[model samples]
Target: MAALQGAVETTAPVSRLHEQRSYDPADFGVPTGREEEWRFTPLRRLRGLHTDAPLPGGKVTVECDPAPEVTVENIERGNRRLGTAYVPADRVSARAFTSFAEATVVTVPRGVVASRPTVISVRGDDPAGAVFGHVVVELEPLAQAVVVLDHTGSATYADNVELIVGDGATLAVVSLQDWASDTVHLSHHHAQVGRDARFTHTAVTLGGSVVRLAPSVRYAGPGGEAELRGLYFADAGQHLEHRLFVDHGERNCRSRVTYKGALQGADAHAVWIGDVVIRAEATGTDTYEYNRNLVLTDGTRVDSVPNLEILTGEVVGAGHASASGRLEDHHLFYLMARGIPYDEARRLVIRGFFGQLIAQIEVPELHARITSAVEAELA
Candidate 1:
């Protein structure tokens, strides 16, 4: 680790270029395996990768059938900011910092409603090195759009992304993380909602050696709404963790979060932490969060912590719930006695567990794709 640090410090030209054109891992305060937030995660797994961050050579492609009438821009060389906060050095870990970059920017003008989904695909080849990329979204007042982000790598690398949505706009953002077998992924997504704006985020994690996804959203204006939805599967010895924070900074705002996971095989571990905060001035706030996990093997483990903090008494409603357990024997037996194959029966039960949330997606094609991917991973 020290050698890698020294290499980054010694490479003056590359370091300067990274600073001028892209996000530096060092700026985010990469973890040294000593921080409390990183205690549960294994840091030694990143020892083999090259410490020096790679240039933004990865290819980013966008596709939208029946494309939107609004202007679509692909920003190749530009500084993209995620909301108003700069990348604080102490808040970022070394591994997490390597994956930061200024992503392509997409802007939707006010009052424009897109007719099709916008698909953004990013691909990289530095499996043994570090890869960084970013995607910036700005929606004008009364604008409506659906954006899909798909991340995949040919080699093992850490990935990071930052997203921003504007005021009085509605953005339906979906993210899919599919990395190589030996890949280690660390992702950070930060979003801000403006007055009367709506932001919906849905994430599906299906492949990676070790994956940690953290999404932080803030409702900074009155009457704004934010919704977070996610589905994950950890099989065999994989480790997957998701942490979400929703901040209500204004009055008359609402937020809802629901995340579910399935764990199978020994040493498969999954962790979920949901945190919601209603500020003192945030009156008429409504928030709720729930996390559920289904354990298929005795050796598998899951830890869930759902929390809510209210600083004012004028809030309308707030609550949180968490549950972690195995499949009920009665439900399994009943399925088997009905002549269903054991494997098929187990698959049915797992699908039903996530089906409720999957059914909530407004897009038919997206809903079907998510369901098929979950089935394939669990099967």
Candidate 2:
């Protein structure tokens, strides 16, 4: 019954509770690992973010290089522009809402197409501290822009990101969680697509001791479109999770999600939860989500779940798929028989699996960097 009418998000996945939005942290309860949303997560490793951990500022730094047509500003908390496109959906998210000192706002003027991609670099210098951050991106009507959020270094971080795509605009956001091995990160991303607008979100998570990313989308008017693509790799003793929600509340809107992941070494774990909801008002809605995982070694864990909730069947179609298993022997054998060494063949197989998705990225530098990082992860 996932073509959902209402549901709440948590650390583990999307739960069946009625959805609620709030800026107050006290409105959300600390997850005890027993709730549906917190079941698959390791709560102890969250650095108390789900509980009472102090969300200090200045522990992490954010730098942005915007295109000539774009404007970037750092505004203090309580700014009206900060939460217009976002709402706290979970405990860590609520905590982040109350903890961040300043929020970064990036705006693309109406009808202006950005000449270059905006690059926002976030780095944590202290592994012993915790940080909270917020970022908002607004694309005015008919504007087109691409934004990249890059995370690195070590720290316990919780952050929220908001994207507002105005009518007829097209916006793409690429978020990378290439943190240090000892880092822990919790992030929430929300996008509001206006009438006839198009939005694309890409999540590339490759590092960190624990990384949990939740990205959700909602349509403001009819004919909106959304596309979500992601790829992640979990190594030994690492926990990487992604939770996605697509709320089709407007007529004739469409959404598509495709996520791929690879796991290796003992204690390497990955989780993917895709939730697509076609509300009663969302007639002629079309959506599909699929997730695939590759197991590179024994002693690895993969949890993949796809949920499609259709409130009104009067329109288009909805579907989802999830699968996880070891590398296909036939594919490997076929490559090896082509005179390719076993190691080279294995890497080639992985490259084929993720290359297509990465190719969709419009940013050349970020695209090349992710390709190199994927190669390094395989090596």
Against the unseen true structure, what C-alpha lDDT does each candidate score?
A: 0.68, 0.88
lDDT at position 235, candidate 1:
84
Residues 1-379 of candidate 2: C-alpha lDDT, one tens digit per residue: 1122112233332324328788888887888998766778899998788996554443789999999999999999987878888889888898888888889899999999999999999998876778899999999999999999999998889999999999999999999999999999999999999999999999999999999999999999999999999999999999999989998889999999999998899999898888887888999998999888888888888878777777887768788877787777888899889899989999998998999999998787887899999999988
Which runs of model 1 end up more than 4 angstroms from their true locations?
A: 1-30, 47-66, 76-102, 155-160
Error of 1 at 200 (Å): 0.9
Q: What is the TM-score of each candidate against the true structure?
A: 0.83, 0.95
- Judge candidate 2 against the unseen true structure and give its global Cα lDDT, from 0 to 1: 0.88
Query: Which pairs clash inside model 2?
Result: 2-309, 3-308, 3-309, 3-310, 12-37
Q: In terms of TM-score, how similar is model 1 to the real structure? A: 0.83
TM-score, structure 2 vs. true? 0.95
Give a tens-digit lDDT track for model 1, residues 1-379: 0011001111222112123212454444446665435555676765433244333343333343323655655444333344233232223333344344444567778788888777777664555555545556677788888878776665444444445556788888888777655567666666778888999888787777777777767775899898998888888878888878787879999999999888888888787767787888999999999888887776776767665777889998899877777777788899999999888888899989999878876565877878898888866
Per-model tally of clashing residue pairs: 11, 5
